[model samples]
Target: MVFDDKNADQAQSLREKMSGVRNGLKVITLASGKGGVGKSSITVNLAIALAQLGIRVLVMDADFGLANIDVMLGVQTKHNLTHFLRGERRLDEIVHIGYDGVRFISGGSGMMELLRMNEGQLSKVMHGLTKLDMPIDYILCDAGAGINDNLISMILASSETIIVTTTEPTAILDAYALIKTIVKRDNLHPLHVIMNRAESKKEADHVLDGFSEVLAKHLQKEVNRLGHITLDPEVPRSIKRQTPIMISAPNTSFARDIRSIARELLELPPQKEPGNVFSRLFSGLRK
Candidate 1:
């Protein structure tokens, strides 16, 4: 097939622009009102699924108190976020590569100490992150459940916040409560939802509807429904194997759903400017 010169030039220009802007590194923070809703599972598989589409993804396990993305992904720990926090290593040194080309930064055990860092340390960490060499397409922060200050900081910094919840009434209530807090605290609008462990589409819809209604009526905000993962046994089995469902059981329905969600997220228009020379230069100077 003959290539069109005009199209080729346009493609090249787009690539140049993307390279200049750092290629749209979107930061998506996943949080839950309560634990046990498979937040880490979703985060891991979603990263893998996105990477399957040739998108470079980094899953940052931000659940400081009880971090386990490393264990779930079966990545043996040589070093973790603690090393970076303690200035023993740089952020890039701690990244662990996993299935389907996903890279992860393990949230070291007892990282609650890092949370106590004075403003200077926190600023240093943030500055360090911007200087990393990897051109990450997405930085998925799997934050701890609840509305603590750390979690709030993560939510505010992220380009988008995904709230995972199950069909239980308590889960729904907590999800609403968390969104309400975010709205009031940040003065932000709707928060995204990922309904997990639903038995059917109807069940997922019910869960989404309940949250949407509350947000609309009570908070005067809209809750965007990203999608849902069904009650698939393959999920837990894959977790037990310490592998992502997208890699361990790609043919399973749960894997299919994960892939679908990844596609949806990828297809969404790029939100943040990927990279800029000024930002990179300043980042380098700060180091």
Candidate 2:
């Protein structure tokens, strides 16, 4: 989208607002290099799990491929980044509240082409994030799977990233490639990994160990093993019901596993000034 003179000035104003938005604000981008690894699903449940522990969380659906989070929560997003950029809605006003008060923002839809936005469009959206007034401990971005400038930009802009992958060989390799790409692009980019749909904890541990070794050996990068989610039949059932497992079956092992990952994520310190983006929404404190 070409920004007119007035739009350019407004975007500049939003960028200026970003200067005050980084009071320990934590923005974590969740992604994968391959699809069908349940990245979006985990994004939804993990946000809810964190909220269950009283950590206010906002989940942004950056997965331009599809609004899986929306379908999972059975909620329709009437507004998105475009709306916020148009001056028709505040960034916070476009948020779609999901399970357990976990706020979400749709990444546009249909012709909106969320991922295809130009640099100026993306800059405006990123700057507008500071408009959010509600207190939030974490802003989890469920980035669309695979490699692209948009995906990489989102990850690099966030404080850190959590890459989700399954036990499949292709999935593991793709995850590694994605991580290596990030490190190659910016050696300091913090990254973590989550093994989804593992058959068993033993296997999960084995795979994580091997994967960690590969990363350390090849890329000289250290990525935390956030945790794993084992295969669960109920996960599909919950999806069919349009309710996340964290809400439909919080007592189940699947939900408990998500909570474990959330706890690990809580222990991570927020970047002092993540990419100099996301100014503090609160005066002196955030995150």
Candidate 3:
């Protein structure tokens, strides 16, 4: 909420001096209450879009159950978060390059493994992250779908969370449930939404009207609707080709929607990234 220390400003300035790093390492998680809503796909392309804008970005596949981000990007990973947890690799070693110069880490398939991590290991991991030669501007975490202790903690610790959902009745209901749970825990949490796989802007807005109404009346929270992504034939094809839309089909409507979202995100006021990330993460479980 305030300057962490006197050197906070100086440290931030130094990070900006890096090749193309943005001012702060803004942490964002793109999540959905149900899978198959295209959450990971949006995360992958969104990170690349930000990178294309000259921002040093790192997208983490925080699912902890699936490692599809790499598969979608058509890249293989020699190391992941599991290796770091087992003391087999450093944090930086787990990061791999993706399209448009974006960086990424694949979260291994064991969410609970993090709780067993000790303070010493946590310190080492933190050092590994903060000491990167080229600092990161944003850490976009593709948090796994569904509600759980780990997911809630991740959403709480992030600077902002974009809930990706479709216009399907079930998808909308699940998204509302997710929002209710999050607001129940922290009503003041900053929330946003991305309408994906929509038929048109009219349909997306029709859904938002009822959705945001429920939040304002019952939960007392208003969410920002970033924009909607039209159902483009190019999306599935791009996925099959293992190329991000931003690179393969930049002229498609899908890529245009992503670029618009990236611009909207960049305009947000930067949040202060505190030191000792793991401490803040595990501490949430204690509450």
Candidate 4:
């Protein structure tokens, strides 16, 4: 197969941008204490929102056995991490372009071998990721729900983590559990809390206040509130239709909430000096 010269030029330009990535890449691991809390939905939408702000964004559907970013966007995957792990594909080969200019790497399901990869394989995987030719401003890792070695590694490797939860008691408790675990592992890692499916701002404020209070007293770590998403009927509809809410119903309240969250993240101060490059960060974690 022959490649287009113009495309190659553009690829070269992207690589140049990568080299000059001064502030580094912002890697955020979007995680939850449990499943079914709209974590994946938030991940996909937030990615699009960030991209819409003119920030080149990449989403790593790192949910492993339960990846859903591709399914949620209706993007068919010919090759995912499974093929890459087996040396059948490269990192760029497995990346899928999703709606609103968001690029993502899908995590194919039921690959027990992937979950149990040895050190050599792990090193290869990390090497592939750190060598991407495309330049990106943000990488949102939609990590699998709950705690595990992989999940812990991913979060610990990231510059920041967003803990998504709902107003439900179980969800809140589970969010706290995940936060406690992370704090126990690394207290200096910046943690952001996002309350999803909130019925009212009052409800969200109350829950977040109580949750933050408890976390401060127990973990002695202050959590940043990254805004909240309201319960919108159209969110599920958009998901069922394989479109992001930001696209299908851009005027909806849910879409606005996501955009707001994206803006808040963009307004955040960048890390000084070398920035947070995924390749550097993940490699250090492995060591």
Alpha-carbon local distance difference test for all models: 0.74, 0.78, 0.75, 0.79
Candidate number achieving the greatest TM-score relative to the actual structure: 2
TM-score of 3: 0.79
Pick by lDDT: 1 or 2, better one: 2
Off by over 4 Å in 2: 1-20, 85-87, 268-287
- Which residue pairs show collisions in model 3? none
Q: Model 2: clashing residue pairs? A: 20-280, 21-279, 21-280, 22-279, 22-280
User: How many residue pairs clash per model?
Assistant: 5, 5, 0, 0
Clashes of 4: 0
Give each model a TM-score.
Answer: 0.81, 0.83, 0.79, 0.83
Instruction: Please state the error at residue 282 of candidate 4 in Å.
Output: 54
lDDT of 3 by residue, 24-102 (tens): 6576878898888989889999999889878889888877756578878877777887788787887778888877789
State the lDDT of candidate 2 residue by residue for 165-195, as single tens digits: 9988999999988887778656787888999
- Top lDDT model: 4
| Weakest lDDT window of 10 consecutive positions for candidate 2 | 269-278
lDDT ranking, high to low: 4, 2, 3, 1
Question: What would the TM-score be for candidate 2 when compared with the true structure?
Answer: 0.83
Residue 245's lDDT in candidate 4: 89
Error of 4 at 186 (Å): 1.0
